[model samples]
Target: MNHPNMKKDQPVTLQTFKKGDKYHHKIVVEEAGYINDVIFRLGRETPGSYNGQQITVNYEEQGGALVGTVKYPAHNKVIHNTYEMDGQNLAKTSECEGVVHKRWYNKQQN
Candidate 1:
C-alpha cells in the first residue's frame, strides 16, 4: 500500500506486536533488496521491553530524514551508543545477552 519508491529514511523491524493494538512493522529497507544494514537483537520480551535507556532508531518514511544506531546495555555487550544512520546502525541494537532478535535495516536515498 505504501511503496512509491518508498524513500524517506527507511529502517524498520518491529515484528510480532499486539500490546494494545496497531500491528505490523516488519521493514528491512533497501528498496526491498538487501545490502547490509539489518538488525534487531533485543529480548526481554521485545525491543523496548529489553530495558530502555534511550533507544532511538528513527526511519521517518512519512516524508524523509532518518539516521540509525544508539544502544547501551554494557556488561555483556551492546555499546555503540550513537552513530546516526549508515554507520551501520551499530549492529542493529539489542544485545546484552540478547534474546532472539534480528530484523532491522535502513535504505533510501535519492
Candidate 2:
C-alpha cells in the first residue's frame, strides 16, 4: 500500500474471466508504451448480484496507484493467484481468484 503516484517500472496487465459461475476481472497500465488506463471489476452470484462477491480493482498512474483483489468462488472451486511481481503463479481458473499489488515513487528522492 505505497502508491504515492505510481512510477517504478510501470507496466502491468492482468485479466481473468469465468462464464458459468460468472466472474470477470481486468487491469491494465502502460505509459511510454501506450495504453495507460483500464480498470474493471465484477462479481456475480445471480439474484440481485453481489452474492458470493469480492471485487476491488483500481488503477491511476502518473505517479502511483495500482490495486487489485477479486474473488468469486464456486463451480467446484479451484482458483488461486499470487503474483507479487516475482512470486509468480497466477494461472487458476475454475471460478476466479486474483491478487495484485503495486506502489512506487522515486523522483530523485522525492
Candidate 3:
C-alpha cells in the first residue's frame, strides 16, 4: 500500500546550510546497509523566520556500510543513491533511491 514513487539509477546526498540569510535542510538515505529516512525540518525560508523544526534519526553499520545520525549539537552524514530494482505489486518502488525491496501495494483506492 505505497504509492508516491520515485526510482531511477538512484544516488542522492543533498546538503544545504546558510545561517545568516536562510537555507537549512537535510535528507539522508543510504542503501544496502542502513540509514533510511533521516531528515531536517527546514533549510530555506524568508517569510516569517520559518518556525517548524523536528528531526531525529540515528544509525550505524560497518560491514555493509551505512551510517547517519542526528542528536542536536552536530553530526549528519548519509547521502548516496544508485538504484536498480524494479516495480510491481501495485507500486513497489526501489529502482534506485536506495533500498526498498518488495513492500508496496496501492490498488488506487480513496
Q: Write the per-residue lDDT of candidate 1 for residues 7-67, one digit (tens) a residue.
A: 6666544232233433223434456453322233322212331232433232221222222
Residue-level lDDT of model 3, residues 24-92, one tens digit each, is 443333442222233232321112111132334333333432233333323232223221223522322
Which number leads on lDDT? Answer: 1
What stretches of model 2 exceed 4 Å from their correct place? 26-110
Report every candidate's CA lDDT: 0.35, 0.34, 0.32
Per-residue lDDT over 6-67 for candidate 2, one digit per residue giving the tens place of the 0 to 100 score: 58766555454445644344444544332322224232222211222443332121222122
Worst 10 residues of 2 by lDDT: 58-67
Error of 1 at 48 (Å): 15
| Candidate 1 lDDT score at position 70 | 39
- Report lDDT (Cα) of residue 20, candidate 2: 62
List where candidate 3 sits over 4 angstroms from the true fold.
1-4, 11-13, 21-23, 28-54, 57-68, 71-110
